[model samples]
Target: RATKSLSLTATSPINIALVKYWGKVHEQLIIPANSSLSITIDQADLCSKTKVELIPTAEGAEPQLRLVLNGKEDKITSRIRSIIELMRERTQGVRAHDDQGHTLTLDASELRTHSLIITSENNFATASGLASSSSGLSCLAFVLSQLYGVSESFPDEYTKFARLGSGSACRSLYGGFVQWHRGFQAIQELTEDSAKVSDQSLARAVELSQESMEWWYNNLSILICVVNPGDAQTYQKDVPSTDGMKITLETSELMKLRLEADLAQKHIDQLTGYLEERDFPKFAELTMKESNQLHAVCLDTYPPIFYMNETSRQIIKTATKLNGQGNIVAYSIDAGFHVFLFTLKENQVKVHEAMSVLPGIDQIIITRIGREGVKLI
Candidate 1:
């Protein structure tokens, strides 16, 4: 059979989780203890573009998967090679036909024969403590899955692939209000069995994140405050979010106490209740508390990685103060200290004008909830 060509592409946005994925129960699989929620931003000039292509091979040569990164030929290391191996393992018996009558069998060894090209570019900037890595990696993984014929039912497989590349990539699989269900790898293991259950809870949970009916869609806007992009020389430094979680497990006695007393759930529910009431003060309080908890765990680490600096703190304080009274404005910080300020559309110009004057601030990009994830042309 003659081998044929194939290509796929996906553009993914950087998402900020409301109920964040702080710790993981299963590090290897990237499972989280609690669920997380996020909104996909459309503008503010941040995104990742990924393209995947397949080519036919000759009869005798060893299969090769060439990875060209940023227009340069790159070697596949052990870490990335694992994903190809897993893809081969999962798609062993499955057969895919190209435009020509050729059948492609995914063999671990033969992956090298065809070139798997990946090129990603961030719209605004890279390593400025922005979530570009997450969006880029997630977009690559998503594009590859589509090219390789993987289904969403195999989220663990795809998300695990993404997680190996970037910690937050897994959550990008869904759009609105996603949750990783931390430390729970069995969600994928039992998916086949659970699919038979009558309640269909998994379907419902997936629905919740993918739904477009969330309250903040039209009303909420986010302002991005950029700093020096955080030590550009330290680009793509591996933080290992799971490792951070392990450190939290050992040092954050509060985390253990919350787990034992089920306080995290109670606290999360309280925040949700407040959101239901449209109470900005309470929501802001919970968001600030959660950010503090996340950073506290970061501090609990041996070397103590500090994600939030003086500039980060100033933005937080100013944004919180500006959204005063019964107003519906809020601020939430992610793994990086970048502040994602949620406010009304009417407040956009004023917030931008105000942030422009702040010291150590670079630029502000305004964005709102993006439409559901889609394929690129």
Candidate 2:
């Protein structure tokens, strides 16, 4: 008998980049111009949970794709459609056990006749510069993979699908210190084909020594301070990230320097060393510098995009002040106004106290770094 339907649930943790991914080499393929490193935030504080149901359609009938987020129907974006189509094409005669332990064979032709219903929800605000898309898209990709019986044909194969949905989503597929490589040293080094380049542009977890992992788990504390709460609509960006990156790549002179110097790779290497040595001071310094440079590059753009507000500046000042006495905290901001303060567990209380007094702060969440990525539920 033909399988009636397949369903799976997945949860993914968001990641905050220390070595940020600011630009793209291939926009359609979502390949980055530079490598990035990030720590996966624990799901206890922030995450996206997604469930996918694939119901087979009648012969010759076009399958429908639907997405519901936070209990509201969301338009399935072109980026998302691309992921679904690609996954369907890639699904050959794959076999896997469903959630009920029933053996299922997923064929490409058979998958093409299935309609997908995806329902996702985030514990935190979406599009609020909190990496909600990363967790959301990654969770979707993971659940789809299970339903389609898609296995990793190559290293980080599943991440490739997630990357198509959102550039940062690739990094969210792994836990701990994850690095998303830019794929090639130079675009000229490879053929003009984007397909081959995308295969190389994937994310992997940076292997840390057991001792270092233990230290990180024991001491590291991530404090997320949401500047704007309530509705996600209020926090939408003036310029979408894709458009902002295009402007920076075209007009920002500093972008040329950033690419030529390969600053992202350098920061990744330095940060990795600092993490291994458990050098909090060097780690904090590098983290803050990278964050500053990212925003500076944005300012250098033609239209000059400003993601940080007065409240954001106040948080930076507080982190700096606290660091002056001792390197107790390092703050990193994405293309949004909220601040992620990285500090030791011993100083977490101090950092929280300082952040609480800051005006415009909505709420504070205290969580540790996560050691796992996307998981089936």
The numbered model that scores best in lDDT is 2
Candidate 1 regions exceeding 4 Å error are 1-3, 58-62, 72-79, 92-112, 152-161, 183-215, 229-240, 274-278, 323-328, 374-376
Encode model 2's per-residue lDDT on 239-300: one tens digit a residue.
Answer: 78899998999999998799888888999999999999999989999999999999999999
Which residue runs does candidate 2 get wrong by more than 4 Å? 1-3, 58-62, 93-106, 187-194, 229-233
TM-score of each: 0.79, 0.93
78-142: candidate 1 lDDT, tens digit per residue: 65666656655554332466656566665534454565656556676665657875787777766
lDDT of each: 0.61, 0.86
Candidate 1 total steric clashes:
16
